[model samples]
Structure formats: C-alpha cells, structure tokens
Target: MPAPPPPSAAVPRRRWQSRLSPTLVRDRCYTRSFHSAGLRPAAVPLPDGAVVHLWLPPTAATGANPLHPVLLLHGFGATATWQWAPFLRPLLAAGLAPYVPDLIFFGASASPAADRSPAYQAACIAAAMTALPSAPQRYAVVGVSYGGFVAYHLAHAFPEAVERLVLIAAGVCLEEADLAAGLFAVEDIAEAASLLLPQRPEDLRRLVGLTFCRPPRFMPSCFIRDYIRVMCTENVKEKTELLYVLINGRKLSDLPKISQQTLIIWGEQDRVFPLELGLRLKRHLGDTSELIVVKDAGHAINREKPAELCRLIKNYIVDPSVKYRDDRKGSWKNAIKRFVGSSLRKVDSSRPLL
Candidate 1:
C-alpha cells in the first residue's frame, strides 16, 4: 500500500523566515492572484504514495464542448505558485480551465517513494488530474524548464489524452555530448546540480544571474539567506537525484515520442539550454511542431515576458484566427519540416492512466 500524503500547515513565520521576506510576500500575492482568477487550491492522493496539490478554476471541465483543460507545470527553484501565477488570469480569461500542479516534493505535494524520475512525476500528475471530480477526456499541457521534462513524459505516456503539447526553454533533447561540448558553463552534472540547488546565499546569487536576463544588481543578503532557507532547502536529496536521472543514463534517441500538436517556445538568449538546443528540438519533433523564439530574453522567459508568452499560447490553443503580435520583438518561426517531411506518420506509445 502507498504511504499517506504529507501535511501542509499554515503557521506563522519565524524571524529567520520573516513574513516581510520577498519570497513569503510573493507567495501571499500568488494566493490572492489565484483567488482573483477564479481558481482555488485542491489536492488529490495518487496511488504511488504521492499527494498532488493543484490550483484549478472553480468551473471545472465538464459537459459537451466543455472548456478546454490546460495543465501548467512548473520547474525547479520555485513551486507551481511562483512559476505559474502570472499565467492563471490570462489563460482563464481565454476560456481555458487551467490546472497548476506542484510536482512531487514541491509545494504541498510529497512522496515517500524513492523514485524521482520525470516519468514517475508525470504518472503521479496524470493520476491526480484524472481523479478530479470532472476530469476532461483530453487536455493541453505547458511546461517550462524542468517542468518541460515532466510535460514531455506526460504527453508521451498519455498521447491520446493530451491534445496539444507546449515546451518552453525545456532541453528535453539535451545529450551527454552537449555537456562535454561545454554548451553549459558547469564542469559536470554534479556542478550543474549544485548551481541549480544552491545551499549558500552566494550559490543562490549565481543561480539567479543565470536564470534571469537582468538579475537585480543588489539583493540584500538577508533576503537571499531567507529565500534560500525557505525555498531551496527542502527535498535536497530527492532534487539532486532528479537532476542526475534527467541528465544521465539517457541518449538523444531517448527523446520522448510525442504525437500531439506541439509548440516549442524558447528564449533566444537562453544561457542554460541555449538557442541551439531549441533548434535541435524542432528538428527532432518534426513537422507537427512550431518554434517561437522570444528575442532578447533569457532562460526565465516565462517570468520575464509573461504577456507575450500568454499571447502566443492563447493564439495557438484558443484562437488561431486571432493573431497576436510578438510585442517583445520576438518572431514566430515554424519548423522547416526537415525530418521525413510533413507526411510523417504518428507514433503511439501505451501507458496506464488514472
């Protein structure tokens, strides 16, 4: 039998974890943001001993011609709240029933099982979403950074259920060769993991610099220390394991087999994965995928350019006829349809769903 889900308590913050800290304040704001967007928080238990905490619109997906279901998955560092808060209102207004889930070991979700692979994370989320009171027969997914890895697996695992797939700055096709080629600044996987899951304030600073195009010139050490203590401290072991599992023991050929109408969005100036990987992924995904490069942006493009991102997403999924300009000077560049041409046959893989 699976272990029970973890508890999420709302307790007062200690001096070291002050309420005034930006992280806490932003979290509070995200809560209000969700409420204002017609969404409320909920949780469901998965068979694999993990409880998934997600925020869904009050009007759940139901009935014939129901509102389209959209699942937004967040990456590392911050939980779903911080990463996805900007998208809630925009997507909801566009007639999408958005569901933002904190992957296992993030936010209110937790798992006692030793598994930390993206595949397991995808399975757990699939189970929780399907167990919803009014689950949709099909849904769309948008994942950024690490969440892109989970999204890729989720779409691959449930191809029939996922109607559309979107990956933003997700290096799903990265290989061991990319690391050796010095495509990333880190010396090795361990060094990359350390930088991403920083323990010290200085490490956190380095991470921020890499994540943002224009990181704050001066962040108070107190806030850095507090943020690190609150956000980057928990699930250290499991997160590190996740990093290894995602990067190592995998080849380029292992790229997820997905057939959903796909959209690949990337920051042209992305340092972590770089723009080259995005182009490579476009080639790998074949004609069904479209690539959009957000110019002058970095790895954290979702936060840096939320409105433009939302516009692109809205047009792609909601209203293709309603063309929106890439206000950030970004351009929509569809794939050149190199692999086997646009006549490629769809490939399907079978996996159990909740």
Candidate 2:
C-alpha cells in the first residue's frame, strides 16, 4: 500500500469550500424551480460561433398547445437563471411560456465575435428564435436593467416578431452624457463597470446596497466572496467591454422607439438607473407606453417585489386591452385604482356572457 500521499497543493481549501457553498445550494433551488415550471435547458447555436443558452418550454420544440411566448432577457450582474428564476413560475402560471436566455458571455452563453453592442445581442437572439423549431411567430419581450437595452434593440430590429414590450428598471432612455451630467452616483463608465461587475466583497456589498432598498442585514463576507467567485468572475474583460459599449457614446436622440405597446415598471427608490429614467422612457415612447412605479422598491424590483412585478406582467401580457393612466399625468395610486377598476369592469361585463 502506498502510504498517504501528500495532499495535492493545486486545489485551495477555498475551492473545496465553494463546492458546498450556500450560493450553490440556492442555485440548485433556482434550477429546481425552473424545471418544476416545465422549462428545459438548451443551447441555440448562432452562425457566428455564439451559443445562446436558453430555458424553453417543452412545447417550444413540438408546438403542441403552445402558450403565448415571452422572451426574458437578464441583467448584467448575474446570469439568466440567477436574475430571472423568480419570474419563471409566476409567468408560467399566467399562461405565458417563458423563453429565458443567457446573453452572450453570461452563464453558458458565449460568443467569440468581437461585437459587444446591444444590437449584436439582439441579432443573436433574433437569429436563435428564427432557428428554433416551431418558434412563436410573435412574442412579448420583458427586459430588466441591462436586459432592457437588448430587448429594446430586439423590438426595434424585429417589430414584426415582438408583439409587446415590458421594461423594468431599465434605463434605455439614458444618454451617454447622463453619467457626466450627474444622473448616476458613479463618476464615469469605469466606476459603473467596477460596481456592476464587482471583483471583491466590498464592491459587491456596495452594489447590493445601491440595488436593494433593504439589503440583507447580515451578508457574511465569505458568502459575498463566494458569490463573486461563482457569478461575477467568469467574463470580466468582455463584460467590462460591454459596459463601456453600453454607455460610452449613447444618446437619447439615437434611440428608436418601437411600435409595440410598452410597459415601464420602475422602483420609486431605485438608485441605480433612477426613476427619472423610467419616466424619460415613457415620454420617449409616448402614448404607446405606460409607466408604473412600485413604491419603496429599489433597482432589483423583480427580487424586491416579485409578486407585484408578476401581477403587472401577467395583466399586461394576457390582456391586450389592459391600459394604465396616460403618461401625461397621474399619481401611482391613481393609476393603480384606474387599472383595478377597469379590470373589475371588464370582469363584470364578461361574467354574464360567460
């Protein structure tokens, strides 16, 4: 018997600990939730050596009794699964089939192409949809934060395919000058990238503080480090490039509004993009858009108020006639009252016929 060989020095103790990390456990829960919602993981390959990893319904491939399709694009901080897991079950329950994809360089999705613009991301997604068997001819799109930028481009580039749009805490209306104009807390794009793509525990903490109205009371440093290791370290260079591309020279005048009716949900307390950006987007989209402000919520509205967010999404997607108060002027409460009252009226009017 060869006595005890020396323990391999290559693997650090931290690496061993990460194998049993709580973050991993939570990620497994997210996976289970996705599976329970009848979504399966797949990779849709594009001609440009990019692979988009998606969670598709069983019906997407077979086209049997297909529900309305809704494409979910995730934000910059984490992969599709991490950002959109809370949305899966709620969306499925609302009779909307979710097509959740990890944008390039995130999760299992990757592209070797040099292009990093949102338009490129949109093109990849559009191509993937076209290539998928029995894909929906038209579908709704929901984008959050960074995902909103991509979703906007997708709708603009393929209006025929995108029937409706929803943007949550996405600052697609922001101009490149906004950063220097004191719109954001960060002084410049590099600072924004550092916070968004945190490499250290403190950086993650700052991001969480800005993102959540009430961040975790006690997030241990070890867990933060573990999260950064698992979620933030994979594509640092590319993600940094993406951040620069997103804000470097963007201008509001350059943004093209889509014909699709849009729903803009923002957190009243959002510190990242700020609520003003949501209002700007509504103004840009004009009568085709409605804005909803979730009181007390912050940038991560999906996580902070998942139930409310889901309700808004279901109402907007399931019923084409659903409309909120005009963007001209209305308090949040008034808008909610009008929305609820109209929904009640519709239900009452249909009850007798049913």
Candidate 3:
C-alpha cells in the first residue's frame, strides 16, 4: 500500500485534549494505526437515517485476492476505531477487507429513532453493508461485548448475508436472573448501568477495574473526566435504552437462531460477563461452535490481548482447515499451542508435533 498522507492532511485535529495528554497521544496512535493499515474513513447512512462512520481498508490492502468482507463491531463505551484498531492490519494482511462500523449512538453514528433494541442496531449495520458498492455476498462479523448482541441479531436477521460469527466477551445468553443472582460484580442492574454508563470519574474507574484484569492504578481524575465528557457523554439516553433492552428484553430461549459457523472468545478473568456465559453460548450454538478463552485477561480482551484475538480471528476467517476444540476451561498456553499447531499443519506437513 502507498505511504499514508501527511499527518496534517490524513488525520483531522482534535482540540479537546492537549497533544501531550496520554489519552490524546493514544488516540493519535490509534488513528495512525488505521492509516498505516490503509484504512480510510468513510460514512454511510442507514435506512433508518442513522449515519455510521467507519474505517475501511483500501483496495491495495486486499491485494489480488477476491474480496472477503469482514465486519468488526465494537461494544458499548467506545467507538469502532478504539476497539478494532489492532485487528485491522492483520485482517487486511490476511486478504480480508475489514469494515469497522461504529454502532448507532456511538462515535459518529446516530439514530433519531427511539428504537434501541439489538435487532434495530443489527438492522442498521446490515443496511450499511448492503449499501456498500458491490457488497460481498456473505461476510463475517466479530463483535465484542454489547456489539456481540448486535452481531447475534444481525446473523439471525440476515443469515443469508453472514458466513461466520465471532462473539468476544458478549453475554448474549445471560438472563435477568443472572443479574439478580450477583453473576456480575455490581450489586444490581442499576449499579451495573451506572458503572457501564459512567458519568463520573469514580464510576469510570470502576468500569476500568472490571474491564481490565490489570487496570492502571492511578489514571488522573482529569483524564477520566475528560474521557467521559468526550466519549461517554453522547447519546446517553439511547445507550441506556440499548443496555436495558439487551439485558431485559432477551433470554436464553430467545438467543438468535444463527446457523453460521461461530466462534466464542472470552477473557478468562472477565468480571463483566464472566467465563460461564461464554461456555453457555458455545453449548447453545451447538456442534458448529468453538470457544477460546484468553488467560489473564478481563472483559476488554480485545484491548488486553489484542494480538491473540487478531490472530484467532484472521485464522478462523481465512483458513478453512482451522479447528478449535470446544474447551470451556481454556488457558493462554493451550490456546497458543492449539493456534500454533493449527497454523503449522496448514503449511508444513512434516512440522514438529506440539
């Protein structure tokens, strides 16, 4: 791919945080990562009139291979760029075009409609892909946390358009009873909502503590407050509704009837969704499904263990022979062993045995 445009021309300036702020520097790095991967920003308007801003890989990134579209959906809290930055280059290198969409009410995406259900969110994403010029006949979706709910609904709503499904730390099968039973670290749904949709520094810190297995001990209150102001303050009502509809509106029985090949990835120490939910989802998805858990990680495995997540996703999407055992008690060592072994078998028939 050609060299990225100069910083001034390529990335728009944001004046909210000083350039020296850790957060702003990290944001710049994320944007640079996207540009390095040949992902340029674009926007699409959904049928419901909501607009989605995305970073899409350039034609050159896909090389000479026939286009294989893949959708990367971010969960609640942050934009698609923040969550999927690490995976873009790898997917592009693996000859897959990545479409990273910011869900409605997040980032540059917005829906004026009052509907906040997962199905509605899913529909908006499906419409975006369909609107793409020469849309892929079938695409794969990888969703993290709340995005997984959207992904599940997307597969169910448009199975004909989806070839594979990957759920990361998404608790699609959790029932209201699980919340009542203290399955989550929070006391109740209200507390959970408050933490997830935190408007205060303390609440944001709580969220970080739950999200990361090893969260930073001393994030400046000013940074947390600023992050909440810039990222978490938008569409607060609709976001809350999205959470409510997801946790209260669905049950295990209502899980989407997705027939596509599925992969369930979880963070072993995830406090938000817990590993049990991932195992349950794998079993519910039946024989065609596989579960891989990242050890020493938490709910934000995409951020905590990005390389492993990217490799697993790229392998599953590009390699037809990749096989993942259904292990509910998976660890990092086992996952590495399995992934390396699988990758080896694809190239070297006489490779050393694991």
Candidate 4:
C-alpha cells in the first residue's frame, strides 16, 4: 500500500543542513578586496599539483550592485584570457564577479607532458576550485564549447562544491570522428597559445558573424581578428587527441546527485556540436534544468550574444523558481525525494528520452 506523502514532499532539500552554506562560511572567513584595486591576476593552487591561472575582477569597479561569484572556464586550446577579455565586461554589468581560469594544458597553467587524461583534468579543475578564496565556495560555473564538457564533468565529480552550472555550445556525448577533426580546425597551435601572437582582422569578423544573432559587421574583422592574432590557435593534433579521450571519458549517469541547477545555452546554427546535444543534455540533467537557444548564432554563444547571455544569467541568478531548490529540509521531505528517486530509478532508466 502507498503511504501519504508530506506536504513539502515536492520540495527537495538536504534533510539535515542549514541554509548557511559553505559559501557563507567562506565569505565570513576571507578578507575580500571588494574591487579595492583594479583586476588582479594570480596563479591559484589546486588540490592536485597543477596551478590554474585566475583573474579576480574588482568587485565594485563597474558601479553596479554586488554580483554572485562566477567561474568562467574557456574552450580547449585557449587561455583564460579568451573568456575574461570579451565577456568580463558583460558579466560585470550583470553584477557577477567573474573568476576566469586557464585550464592546465591551455593557458599559462603548467601542464606537464604526463598530465593527459580527462579524469585527471576534471579532478585538477575541482582541486583548483576548492583552493580559491571566495565568500561562498559554492559558485556558478560557466563553460563554453569544449569547456562545457569539462563543466558537466566537474559538477558531477564534485557535487557539493558547485552551486549552479551553465553550459554553452558543449560537445556531443558520442565519440564521432568528424567531431574530433573539427576541434583542430584552428589555423595554428603556437600562435593560438601565446597572447602576444597576432591574427587577421577579417577572420575575427567572419567568426563573429557566424557566432552572434545580430553581430556588428566589424566584430569579426576587428575585435575577434585582432584578438585571434594573439589568441586563436590551430591546435589540431593534441586537441583532437584530448577530445577522443574525453568523448570516451565518462557519462553523467549519477547526475541526479548533483543538487546544482544547470542552464544550457546553445546556438541554433552551431553546426559544430548542434542544438540536439544541448536539448538532450537538458533532459538527462533533470526537469529542473533549463535550455536557452540563441538564433542566428554559431558555436560561440557567449562571444556572439554577450549581452543576451548576460541577461539570461542575471535572470537565472534572480529567479529561484527555475532552479534546483529543495525548499523543505525535513526528514519527511528527504524520505520522499529519496523514495521517489529510488522507485523511478529502474522505470526511468528503461525509458529513453533520446
């Protein structure tokens, strides 16, 4: 016989925990600079041996309200600079204190020849995050393109550590040959690596056209092109190899354990990964997750629609209705979430949405 469920059974929350999360603890502990000076860049230590290149923005510099602490992870073969430079202003305008980091193999972060596996990469990211100084250790992670793959893995690997997740133009779960080939489409690896390197203005312009809904004509030719000269790369071989490894890496079957709310951002015209992957991810993640597809955009959703993207993030930050919040932390509520979770486990597993 089925027993009656509690009034708060629909709400999901930890059975025995205070709302004063680790983030609150961190805020009480760390002496924040609060944008006392300009943007500060540093090499932060991770639990693993790798050091991550991080940019801590001035908290109050933009003359706006205090924002949430955000961690922005860039795509493959690119440095953290790629994220901080273009979108940092938008993020700041939205009242988000952005923390941009260069993954081990990509930016100024030291990556030894031996450090290669995707699991190791994810672990390193978690370790680096655990070491950062923030008011709340729980932060919103925004991963773009290749970085999006890592973002999902990171949230799954370290569930309690992440508060929310934002995936932009991430890749497919399947290991396709063409997908691997496309990653290396960049013109040069060495030039893509160094900040001092230069790229053609026209290439940037074209890229912007392919990425945004209503991008400026000069965007691709000017900003992106100038930026790419020093930033864009042709990291074909190793990046392809990394994708091969990550594609076969692991699946998020235990995603239900992740309490963080997830936001999927996709570009409708992004032929690289395509919209289906994002749509599939939303379902697999859970019903609480949301997906926002940008029209007339390509693989680079953030780069193409920075303002719109910023608005979406801000809305997410303000609205809790679309999030994964377990309102009641009572034992009865916990019992229901767990019971339903376990009962549906077998049935839902058999029902394939894809």
lDDT winner among the candidates?
Answer: 2
Model 2: per-residue lDDT, tens digit, 1-354? 866545574366656775779888788888898888788888998888999988887677567655678999998886778988888777777788888899999889999999999999999999988888778889999998889999999999999999999998889988877765566767688888888889989888878888887888899998898888778888899999998999888899999878999988888778888666776787789889888888878888889889888888888898888687334335444545544433211221111100
**TM-score of predicted structure 4:** 0.62
What is the descending lDDT order? Answer: 2, 1, 3, 4
Sort by TM-score, best first: what order?
2, 1, 3, 4
Q: Global lDDT of each model?
A: 0.77, 0.82, 0.76, 0.56
Candidate 4 Cα lDDT to native? 0.56
Per-candidate alpha-carbon RMSD to the true structure: 8.9, 9.4, 10.8, 19.9
Name the candidate, 1 or 3, with the larger lDDT value. Answer: 1
**Weakest 10 consecutive residues, lDDT, candidate 2?**
345-354
What TM-score, computed on C-alpha atoms, does each candidate reach?
Answer: 0.86, 0.88, 0.84, 0.62
Candidate 2 TM-score, C-alpha based: 0.88
For 1-354, candidate 4 gives per-residue lDDT tens digits of 898677586344433222324422333222133223245666776544567776666762353434487778887635676454656665667667777777766766755445565556667777765665543466778888777767777787777767788888775343333223332233233322221122455444444443445656434233353345334454434454565455443454523334578777777656445455565576666665766666667666666777777777766765646553223212222333433433211121121111
On TM-score, the candidate that comes out on top is: 2
lDDT of 3 at 317: 86
Candidate 1, residue 340: the lDDT equals 22
Candidate 1 ranges beyond 4 A from true positions? 1-17, 61-65, 320-354
Clashes found in each candidate (C-alpha, N, C closer than 3 A) = 0, 0, 0, 18
List of clashing residue pairs for candidate 3: none
